[model samples]
Target: MTGALFEVTFYLAAPFWALMIVAPRWRWTTRVIGSPWIALPPLLVYLTLAPGDFAELWTVVSRPDLEALRAFLSSADGAAMIWAHLIAFDLFIGRWMYLDARRRGVPHLALAPVLVLTILLSPIGLLAYLLVRAVTPEARRLHDREREDQPAQ
Candidate 1:
């Protein structure tokens, strides 16, 4: 169980870091990346609830010699770290999405609240954004045109 949990955390972190690097250059990559902010909570919950053995595994892998890092690995600090990471990641994803929407000509004023909601309550925020995007006739037309322009396999 410890190993499994550690793997899960790594799994959640890996693609996020990768996308952090890749998404800047590739607009299409953003679609595949989903939203790391929204995706991290369940993994954090799993980490918080899993047994102590998971901490031992994580510490061994991380090999954090600093006092702060060690403290963070401890059960009490671990929860704080999880919450911090979640908020930070969510904010980053929300900002990125907001900027992306703006670059795509989606109005900033309309997108700002949705981005804020996503940062505060990820899944629902994402659902609201999706629903709005889907229902907007112009957005739907653009999406359909993009689909039609796809090259044949």
Candidate 2:
């Protein structure tokens, strides 16, 4: 049922989050996270739910009317569709953050909490990660090194 699908959407993404947060140092984590498809399950749910209400959704999106959007979101199906969409994008964002952190040699300790925050509140989590990324010595050093390696104009 729609309710069950709504409830299970987050579960579909939980394992990938577990790998990124709980087993970040594991070699398989990187291997597994390498595929951007990790976000596909919830996205599939979004796809499944979208066509049922495509007309209304298109209207809500295209016109940007506050009352119309509120009405759209008031329905169970609309809420579920939006939830699935959020879960998929959040996982995708989290994956990117994890991979970028690893590449920059940002310590796992610093990133773990950020990933958790991303799960709970992505905008804040993204801000926190950006702040961490900006201040991280390794990230700055890598940026400088990469800049130096570029051929001068």
Candidate 3:
């Protein structure tokens, strides 16, 4: 049952990823991503796994030691809990990236691959997106607002 729920957690998260990656331009995608509750399903998975062995989890987390964490996450339940945790956080990060990109007026074509890379490996994906953001200007209104603040230079 624990293992099954582990798989179900990712399945639940997949659609949000799809919405952000595939149908990113849709009005509904933006509306749907606006809700933080998109994280609820994986949080439920965490709730299920945590109640059963919270003491061990507490130790592993509080110590912040590599060996302790490795030992705890070695178990099926611990692994599932951590997986759920990752799924929830990754989705949240992805959602933020999506909304921020849209608000910044970053092009969809440029962001799609970055979102895919995030799903595969988040650190690299984030680095890539940061590079994109550094080079790409935000919405023109932002630049205009900045100009208003500057005394004629």
The best candidate by TM-score is 2
User: After superposition, which runs of candidate 2 have C-alpha atoms over 4 Å from their true positions?
Assistant: 149-153
* lDDT values, one for every candidate: 0.57, 0.95, 0.87
Off by over 4 Å in 1: 1-54, 57-74
Candidate 2 C-alpha lDDT tens digits along 1-153 = 779989999999999999999999899998999999999999999999999999999999999999999999999989999999999999999999999999998899999999999999999999999999989999989979999999999
Clashing pairs in 1: none
Per-residue lDDT, model 3, residue 46, is: 91
**What TM-score would every model get versus the actual structure?**
0.49, 0.95, 0.89
Residue 125 C-alpha lDDT in model 2: 95
Per-residue C-alpha lDDT of model 1 across residues 29-51, encoded as one tens digit per residue: 45645554545544564546444
Q: Candidate 1 or 3, higher lDDT?
A: 3
Root-mean-square deviation of every model: 12.0, 1.4, 3.1
List clash counts for every candidate, in order.
Answer: 0, 0, 0
- Model 2's alpha-carbon lDDT is 0.95
In terms of TM-score, how similar is model 2 to the real structure? 0.95
lDDT head-to-head 1 vs 2, winner: 2
List the candidate numbers ranked by lDDT, top first.
Answer: 2, 3, 1
Candidate 3 lDDT over 1-153, as tens digits, reads: 899989899888899999999999798988899999998899899999898989999998887999989888899999999999988888888888898788778888888999888877887888888777656767455646767999986
